[model samples]
Target: MKHYLPQVRFWKIISIILALTGVLFTLIGIFCTEGALAVHWGSDGTPNGFAGKIVLVLIALMGVLSMFSGESFRKERPGWHIPVGPEMGYALSTGLTGCCAGVNVIVVLYYFRPDERIPAVGAIAIIVLYLMFIMIAFYRDRRYNGRDVKTGEESHR
Candidate 1:
């Protein structure tokens, strides 16, 4: 292993965040009353303020996933359970986040009156950041991961 590999341990921490956020989004859909507020409903839409909490939780989770994916991309070889590239893993984690964010935004706007402000700017920002993180992670993974050109297969180096 390269000395730099250990330096990226922080990235794994990030990945777990993404995975857990997916779990949170699933939970919110089931338990929260303010599913509509995800779009930005002020008060009238859904009785539950839980949607906001879920969104916040989701944002944190995605951010963590992005970081961890990047770390693993550099560190993980073609092991038993893992394939190659951070794309598949990162996408799986963040896709749910993006979907939930989209759904929340839509439902919030559709049901709630405009006069009521739920504030979706934070959610939008979170999505953008998470996406950016994934991009960076994938780029790094591409450089460090995958098969070596010499043998056209995974390289231990």
Candidate 2:
């Protein structure tokens, strides 16, 4: 497990960086905008609801909390049902954090550009790409750590 430290650290750093970026963008949007920020969007690429600027602050806090949670990947916890190792945890954390950051950026974009709207397909594509990245990271990490991807067991080699 010691060998997995570097990889874990890398993901943790990436998660933090992305989270911080999201927070910064949110703060900027909150301060620069005059009215409530768009919170919910309809499938037709229109925001049907709005939220106070404080919501952006809460979102920023969630981003920070998520970065902290990603630290759990550094070590194993007792009695955990999922047999995820540290490397896999870190990779998954990065994926989740990346998604949150994407959402934050989109929110900020909505604030800055009220006339524009993000297509639902674009959002779905972003999610799919992040999921693919997470899967690829897990596969590569498992190969590097000498584990069988299908069984999640150590390889004889």
TM-score of each: 0.34, 0.73
Off by over 4 Å in 2: 1-7, 71-80, 115-122, 147-157
- lDDT per residue (tens digit) for residues 35-126 in model 2: 88787888676888888777777777776666555447555567656666666666666666666667777777777775544535447856
Supply candidate 1's per-residue lDDT for 29.
Answer: 48
Model 1 residue 88 CA deviation in Å: 4.4
Tens-place lDDT per residue, model 1, 84-142, is 34454554344444444444444434344443333454446557766775666566566
Using lDDT as the measure, the top candidate is 2
Reference-based TM-score, model 2: 0.73
Highest TM-score model number: 2
Please report, as a residue range, the 10-residue window in candidate 2 with the lowest summed lDDT.
1-10
Model 1 clash tally, residue pairs: 11
Candidate 1: C-alpha lDDT:
0.47
